[model samples]
Target: MADTFAAIATPLGEGGVGIVRVSGPGSLNIMKVVFKECPDKVEPRHVYYGHALDASGNVIDEMICIYMRAPHTFTGEDVVEFQAHGSNVSLRLIVMSAISAGARIADPGEFTKLAFLNGKLDLSQAEAVIDLIKARSEKPLSIASDQLNGSLGQEIVAIRNNIKDVLAQMAVNIDFPDEDIEQVSCDEFITELKRQNDRLQSLIKSSEFGKIAREGIKIALVGRTNVGKSSLLNGLLGENRAIVTDIPGTTRDTIEESSSIGGYPIVVVDTAGIRDTDDVIEQIGIERSKNEIEEADLVVMVADGSTELAAEDFEIAEHVANKKVMLVINKEDLGMTAAQSDIDKLKSIIGCDTGDIVYTSVKTVKGIGKVRDAIERNLARGFIKSDGGNIVTNERHKDALVRAKAALVHGIELLEMREPLEVAEIEVHDSFQILGEIIGETASEEILDTVFSKFCLGK
Candidate 1:
């Protein structure tokens, strides 16, 4: 018998209502003790209005409670939920009352863990529940929801079934050596292994875009002082998020803000201008700016279009030479003094011939849309389309796929070398188990603990 567990499902704060959840065989009995006006036989899946009483039979709060019977509940157990006024004291007392009525407080993620153990959800879908909760944007939320609907699991199961068919062919060859059957030749074996490997490679490729969608892209604005970096940041965000002024080092520290562009989340960072500065604080800010450039997914090099290119501008370009860079020539409204020739000169100086160069005026907001489009185009290039396809967004899934691919490659090599069938079978079986780990069929206890530990209590 499973132990009964209770927890406050909602966030702990003032709200219109709060929910206290209990799940296990003893849930109904606990409800009978704490709730008044309870019928001797309560109907499942129905809400009953009642007063929650303490251990001493004193009314604690008027509440609405619902009871869900076994096999249909989230944890596949008898479940009860108390909806009471959103008061910390009241919710705590209710939880205490349930505990006194023979329920124990649930551990973090215990509810979802129970659902996984009882076969209500696979490990992938259970993991998706947490992703859905922590998603910061629509794309991530949509991806997580799709995974929860079993897209990724279905794909993995299909791949496993195909591998199983190949294994069965090998088994038949081993068991019926003298029988006249269509034997799996070395070429056919390699072909089948390569086919499944290609599918794994496709899924691995999708992970890159899935990661970007789950975690927004980070873009750093790098340039010399007083080049409208702050202005550009404000313009991109469509609001004044950074201080803009004529002072060279007004922004001595990096300012980060998030916004959505073309349905993709992006973290825009405005860094201090890269130039010679004697001030200690400005030096630290410049160092931090260099670090941000190193870590940024994309670097937008802002240049002043109103003035001729200076030595400092060339120096800044050289710093971000090897990074994924987009050159932005700001202040175009003031009559562009820096022309295409200047851009070519800077590109040559930076040793980067390929980059998106957009002319914009933060003051007039001209050509800002073009700059944004360049960013979206660069980020979305070669990214897999998210249209109800199985996309692996989790690092664990990627690692497992990598191992599985390696095993398949090894198996194919063995077949090509004319090694004994048993040796090749070993590698193929290893690949099968590796793939199973992704959907939790072969996952160990430690992996499950590590995964569910990231979830919050009562998930």
Candidate 2:
């Protein structure tokens, strides 16, 4: 029998309400002892108004409590919850009362772990619960929610089923060598293996976009001094997050802020203008800017449209020549000093054959939308459309898929070489096992511990 586990489910702060959760066989018994005005037999799945009590039967707080019976609860066991005023002290006291009533404090993520162990959720769905909690934007939330709803697990199940069918065919060939059982030909087995391999490849391909959706992309604004980099940052965020001025080198350090474009989260970084400076502090800032450019997912090269291209502009362009770059010609309202010919010359100088160039005036906010669209387009280069399909978002899932793909490829090669069906079966079995790890069907205890340990308590 599992020990009853209790935890303060809400954050340790004041809110509208706080919840103390209990799960296991002893949950209702502990609830009966700790809640005042309790009936001899509590109705399952019904909320009851009551007051929490201490060992001396003194009222701890006015509360509402609910009891859910076994097999239908989060952990497939008896579960209870006490909802009380959102006071940290009161919540802790309530949890202590439950502890005194024979409910032990739960470890981090123990509740969800129990849910996984009890067959209430698969490994993927259990992992999705944490992703849902940590999601920072709607796109990530949507993906996580879909995974929790079993989209990814269903796809994995289908692939595994296909592999199982091939294994079955191989088994028949081995078990009935002299019988008239029709054996699966090498070509047929290879065809099925290749189909599954292609599916896994597609999933692996989606991981990049899924990662961007989950963690957001980092974009660094690079340019010479006084070219409206700060202004463009403000425009993208639709707020004044950076100090803007006509004086050069006003922003000596990088300023980072979070915003979303086209439903995707983005970290916009306003970097110091790239230039040769004698000031020690400015030099440090410029070095940091170079480092930021190196680490950025994309770089926006801001140029002054109101003035002719300078040596510094060319220097900046050359610095970011190999990076994924979008050229923004700011201050277009002031009249164009750098025309298309100048842009062509700048591109030639940078050795970049093609780039997204947007003409904008940060002062008038013209063409800001164009710049945003260009960013979205660049990021979506190889991104697979969602279309209600399973996307591999977690690095663990991607690694497993890669392993599975390699095993399948090896199996196909063996088949093409006319190796014994039994020999190729080993590789196919390995692929199946690798896929099973994704849903915890064959995962080791250590992997389970590592995954669940990242979850917050009471989840």
Candidate 3:
């Protein structure tokens, strides 16, 4: 790039160290101009201790600076970094000095974008950079690492190559029109396309769990007041995140947190207990609880085993009947006072079976492990049908796969209908182009902007 770009590389805050980074063709000039006492001779990828100087040669901050030459740096361009004391003020001033010399502020994800543009990473791998930054759990982090290491990209490339081979065979039939060659090629194309089609179907199927692993599942804990919803939340999280009390409306607002369970990221929302109440705030909370139930992927219906199901309980059950649900009968330590008929009837209302039920006592923490196991089991059902690695986690990648898969299906259908090889070649070419979009081979500027916009500044 003609213009050098600078930014506060590390997050702005008080820490052990903060870095101001510069990248592009003019990166060295910014370093030489802003870093006072910089040696006449600069070494690529070598650290030098110095002070940042403004236009007047006034010292702004003391720091260790490093410069790396083009083609071997993160952005495949000359890069410089000023590692100073962790203060936003100092980092900003250093960046300002760099800008005054020959640099401008870098945009969000600009560095990674440069890497992608310079052949250092593909589009899917570039996306994983943001995913790695935002991951809150090990599952997503591992998935991101795999993707960044080219797990998904390699798989996509291999599939693209197979499709290319099939297209090459089709080209021979299209040009020659030899009856025997056409027949042989048609049989070969159907066989190979069926294999690739099955792979595409598996990836699309695995995308369900991949979405959960990447974005985390939103679970809403719903039940009538005094049914131990808060207790169950605290138990599930293994911390006193929610304030549990004997008071009817102690938790009058939703409490949300991120955690990991069963190799998946989970966003558990402890919404206020669902109940009909005259209290204005309680009514508002109850309304929010209803909304959470509607939005949640899994509706956890916690019921008290010591008390009979109330009208509100029946109403809550009916509301979540259309969602994926798990029934937790808490307070088992209090003895089974709530009748079997009532519990079974509640399960019937929610359309869940005996296997979906778990009994727990938040006091003694009895059956809490079973509750977690139950949740994991619920998430695991029909989720993994393959080795489980290389699952498609990005929606963009999945969408591309879907479109490519559709084109392949259409081509196969045409061949089966004894259509001309010319017509089938068009579908095959469409499939190739669609697959290329996943790796930015045919991606438009708009697609790149949308993908990189999700990143934080100075990434």
Q: TM-score for all predictions?
A: 0.92, 0.94, 0.89
- Candidate 1, superposed: residue stretches over 4 Å from native: 347-355, 363-370, 382-388
lDDT at position 341, candidate 2:
85
Candidate 1: tens digits of C-alpha lDDT, residues 1-459 = 789989999999999999999999999999999898788999998889989998888999999999999999999999999999988889989999999999999988999989988988888888899888978777888889988988898889999999989999998887887899878877988898899999999999888887888778989999999999998899889999999899889999999999877777789999999889889999999999999999998988999989997889988988898887888888888888976787888877656436477777766555668778878777766343645567788999999999999998999899999998889988999999999888889999998998889988767
Best by lDDT: 2
Residue by residue across 110-178, what tens digits does model 3's lDDT show? 999999999999999999998888887877888889999988888878888999998887777777775
Indicate the worst ten consecutive residues by lDDT in candidate 2.
Answer: 380-389
lDDT of each: 0.87, 0.88, 0.85
Model 2 C-alpha lDDT per residue in residues 44-125, reported as the tens digit of each score: 9888998999766789999999999999998999999999999998898888899999989999999999988999888999
**lDDT at residue 394 of model 3 (Cα atoms):** 86
Best by TM-score: 2
In model 2, pairs of residues that clash are none
TM-score of 1: 0.92
Q: lDDT for model 3, please.
A: 0.85
On the 0 to 100 scale, the lDDT of residue 270 in model 1 is 98
